[model samples]
Target: MENEQIKTIFEKEGITSEIQCPKAFEISEKYGVSKMEIARYCNKNNIKIRACQLGCFK
Candidate 1:
């Protein structure tokens, strides 16, 4: 992940700070949504960081 791109993802998501072990599933699961939904969201937003990208779909 490029430095600027990482910054952009956080700022775009209104999460402008450091977070820890922050898996997308944590947010989606609480909404009764599929983890894959988060993956798609990231893709749509152009946040291509591999750690955030996932293979959670069946």
Candidate 2:
């Protein structure tokens, strides 16, 4: 989803009220994996990820 568009949806759900989801890092940690592992896996899978750089979830 477009970042801004996602933010609005999150706000309605009382998540950020300004931004979408706290951040990717926070999400990854919950999955029991380092952020680096996530990046590497994404690359290996040919997902074309260019570093999460979100620094929001982890």
Candidate 3:
């Protein structure tokens, strides 16, 4: 998915700076995108994903 699309989803879902475990899984399932991909995107864009198993951005 495009970065703008991803950002839109995050914004629509109220996932601003941080995404918790449940929200992460929810977005993964809801958007048909993997948790790793979301985590990676957030990490690359300087957003924080709390308590993710993939260890987002330190």
Candidate 4:
């Protein structure tokens, strides 16, 4: 999915924080997107990530 599409998904799904969102697994499951892709988008978009079990940022 495109970055804007991912952001739209985030907004539509009410996902405001990675800490609360759990490595965006919900997005992965709901949208059939990989966490790695979401991580890339998050990183490129300057979105703050915290408590990621997958350590996508690190």
Best by TM-score: 3
Candidate 2 per-residue lDDT, tens place, 8-42, comes to: 43344444322223333553455444555544443
* Residue-by-residue lDDT tens digits, candidate 3, 1-58: 7677788899999887888877888888899877767867787788877775655324
TM-scores for every candidate against the unseen true structure: 0.42, 0.39, 0.77, 0.72
Clashes of each: 0, 7, 0, 0
> Is 1 or 3 the stronger prediction by lDDT?
3
- Poorest lDDT segment (10 consecutive residues) of candidate 1: 15-24
Ranking of predictions according to TM-score: 3, 4, 1, 2
Number of the candidate with higher lDDT, 2 or 3:
3
Whole-model lDDT values for every prediction: 0.45, 0.40, 0.78, 0.72
lDDT of 4 by residue, 17-39 (tens): 55344637766888988877887
- Candidate that would win on lDDT: 3
Question: What residue runs in model 3 are displaced by over 4 Å at the alpha carbon?
Answer: 53-58
Alpha carbon deviation, residue 52, candidate 4 (Å): 1.2
**lDDT at 36 for candidate 1?**
53
Across 1-58, the per-residue lDDT of candidate 1 in tens digits comes to 4434544555564643322225445544444445555445455556443343344522
- Any runs in candidate 4 off by more than 4 Å, and if so which? 16-23
